[model samples]
Target: MRTDYPYDLAISDLREFLARRVTHSNVLSEFQEELDSSLKRKTVPMRFIFEKFIKYTNEHKQFVPYTKDEEDMIDDLFHFWG
Candidate 1:
């Protein structure tokens, strides 16, 4: 009998996927810190600050490359219970 495993998957593809997930997680964690600081200071609204930060950081290719929809989803998740 043959197993239905993904034997054709390349190691490089797995590495790339892991790297992307890690980078995305790191960016979101960093954003959480910024959000907390901003909230404590009462400087601006959380959503506004998050949107501005995402817009500015996303311009550079070196940073996390979240699409507009992904950013919106992340924003919603972060604020959902907070």
Candidate 2:
């Protein structure tokens, strides 16, 4: 699917983040699930979706929580939209 500016950047950031941490298929699946959920919010900005995604992965424990530096790598990409 075609993606615009910061949304595309956010997806890149997410894919990169998952690339580091995903050791199994289920993790990738869960990431997709969260991404889809965030994407469904047509009214919300990408930055908020990105933040919620980070929170879900951090809190849900299906995937490992991000380290501070790891969070830094992915978190700011969507802020470019604002």
Error of 2 at 32 (Å): 1.2
Looking at model 2, the pairs that clash are none
Give the Cα-based TM-score of candidate 1 against the true structure. Answer: 0.30
Expressed as tens digits, the lDDT of each residue in 1-82 for candidate 2 is 2234445456656666766665567757766666666556522255554565567567665566669866564445434444
lDDT of 1 by residue, 1-82 (tens): 1122121222222233334543556655655565556546643243554464556456644475666755554444344412
Candidate 1 segments exceeding 4 Å error = 1-23, 45-82
**Against the true structure, what is every candidate's RMSD?**
13.9, 6.6
- Which segments of model 2 are wrong by more than 4 Å? 1-5, 42-72, 75-82
The global C-alpha lDDT for each of the candidates, from Candidate 1 onward, is: 0.44, 0.57
Candidate 1, residue 52: lDDT: 48
**TM-score of every candidate relative to the true structure:** 0.30, 0.42
Error of 2 at 70 (Å): 5.1
Candidate 2: lDDT of 7?
57
